[model samples]
Target: TYIRHDSKDQFTGLLDKNGVEIYEGDIVKDADSGSYGAVVWSNDKHWGYLFDTRPDYGWSHPVKGFQRNYLEVTGNIHETLLEADNAKT
Candidate 1:
């Protein structure tokens, strides 16, 4: 798992187990332009799959796109993000 430190030394990138960056910075805001589903974030403390830019809340949602494969792709990202968060504190 790789952790991206922001200018402030905070967790910036949450990569997957395969070393693919899933959540970077604020997931709700820092999503990639293409393949938006490649990443996602937790809102209401619930993991939301990355769908696309939402016109209503300015955020995307994952539904019918998340499965075991998704977890494999985001394992590293999750661990790294957690580590970064711990380091910050």
Candidate 2:
């Protein structure tokens, strides 16, 4: 299988509260609200780092500094969103 040569090849340097590795495009949900967002690297912080998503609340925040114990890897963005959309119908 051919992989994209994007910078996503770099390590996200993060993991879920369950020790699951966090990666770009991986969808994450807050254990409390069940709010989900895709894992993405933000340039807003200059050099940049992997941040947990919470579109319902706002944008992404550093996983390192946030409450990692409250985060979970539900699925990746594509399949997870597709599943949600399909369920709505």
The residue-level lDDT of candidate 1 at 5 comes to: 35
Model 2 stretches astray by more than 4 angstroms: 1-10, 46-58, 78-89
Write model 1 residue lDDT over 1-89, tens digit each, in one string: 33443453233244333445444332322223323342444564434545444646555454223232333342334455697999999
Candidate 2, TM-score vs. the true structure? 0.57
lDDT of each: 0.41, 0.61
**Best by the TM-score measure:** 2
Please provide TM-scores, in order, for all candidate models, with all chains considered together.
Answer: 0.29, 0.57
Clashes of each: 4, 0
lDDT (C-alpha) at residue 13 in model 1: 41
Residue by residue across 1-89, what tens digits does model 2's lDDT show? 11222454444667678887666777677787767766676656421223344445556655653666887766665566677999999
Q: Provide the global lDDT of candidate 1 against the true structure.
A: 0.41
